[model samples]
Target: MKINFDKYHGCGNDFIIINNLSNTFPKDSENQIKKICNRRFGIGADGLILINYNDKFPFEMIYYNSDGKISTMCGNGGRCVMHYCYSNDIIDNKSEFLACDGIHHGIINDDYVKVSMSDVNGYEKYNDYLFLNTGSPHLVKFVDDVSSLDLINISRNIQKSNRFDNGVNVNLVSRKNDNLYEIRTYERGVEDETLSCGTGAVASALALNILSLINSKTVNLDTKGGLLTVDFNKSNSKYTDIHLSGKVKKVFTGILEL
Candidate 1:
């Protein structure tokens, strides 16, 4: 079988996106999905996304990590999906779409795509780190310099520890200024560090604010891939109207045979 797919990346977090409105792709084909995401042998990507039909919304986003397992909400992937929908004429400048987490609103402005993220009720403050769920669970730790740390070793140790039952994405953050910060993330599903992570960015920003490390509600994150902006409104202990914005690019389109 030959399957057509389009590739897009939001700040270097790339995905293989397929228009599955016809329900042609099997959601349970784990092995095939894994092969397709293989870097050396297949079309390399951090994950795969399917834009499927929806009853009440413009579309539904189904995501899978490179490991071929269904995963939680991915912020960068969500932004890429929104851009794909808009570029394909499936949605206009603004629309709502459903994902693994819940429904989210998206908007397109010039070259950037802004999406509304789920509200965070609160976070857990640990001795050295902060834990929160910004669509996905993440553990954020402040560091002196994000570039000097051994990310894989540190993140692997945390993953193997008893701290989290399922596992958690680990984020190493360094504050550059009140509004600017640098982040490096080890994603749970990906099981490694990618160029960027949207949900991880959100989690880190919220964590920083909770600790009073930053002075503004709007924060800029410098990921390995690119820069992303997170804006939110805090009322008491809850964060609402959270938005993640960044540039998304269509890399290519191709057909793969299986």
Candidate 2:
């Protein structure tokens, strides 16, 4: 069996997107997706996305980490899917799409996609760091030297710390200017430093704001791969109208012989 797939990226967070609406994939396609995502043996990618047809939503988003397990919501992945839908006329330039977290309203301004994220209600403060879950769990800490930090080595220590059994994405943040932050993230499922982590960026930006580290309309995030921005309104320690904006472009398209 051959499965047609398209590759896309949001701020360097790449994914293999398969049109699963028709259910044309085999019963074990999910497992096959894992193999394709393998960096050493197949088409390397950060993750995989499945766009399923749904009656309640314009489309359904199913996400998977490269490890072959179903994962939670992804910020960059969401934008990638939105762009994929628009580029392929899955919906339009603007539409309501369903994500793993919930309903996401988005608009495509050319290649840049800005998406409204879910509301965040929980915030935990530690000795020197702030933590939050904006669709995905993250730990954000202010750092002095992000570029020189051994993110892969140190992030692993905190990412699976006993405090979080399920695990958490760890982000090292530094205020660049205004509301902009330099961010390096250790993803939970990915378990390594990727070019970017969308939800991690959102969580870091919001946490930095809560800590009074930066104040601006848009939080410009600099990641190892590319740049992403998070815009939102804060009132009484809560966030509203949260939007995650970044780049999503097509890499290529091909069919997989299964």
Best by lDDT: 1
Model 1 CA lDDT for position 16? 98
Model 2: lDDT to the true structure: 0.85
| C-alpha local distance difference test of each model | 0.91, 0.85
**Candidate 1 lDDT (Cα, whole model)?**
0.91
lDDT (Cα, 0-100) at 256 in candidate 1:
81
Candidate 1, run of 10 with poorest lDDT: 122-131
Q: Top TM-score: which candidate number? A: 1
**Alpha carbon RMSD to native, model 2:** 1.5
Using alpha carbons, what is the TM-score of model 1? 0.97
Instruction: In candidate 1, list every pair of residues with a backbone clash.
Output: none
Off by over 4 Å in 1: none
- Candidate 1, residue 71: Cα displacement in angstroms equals 0.5
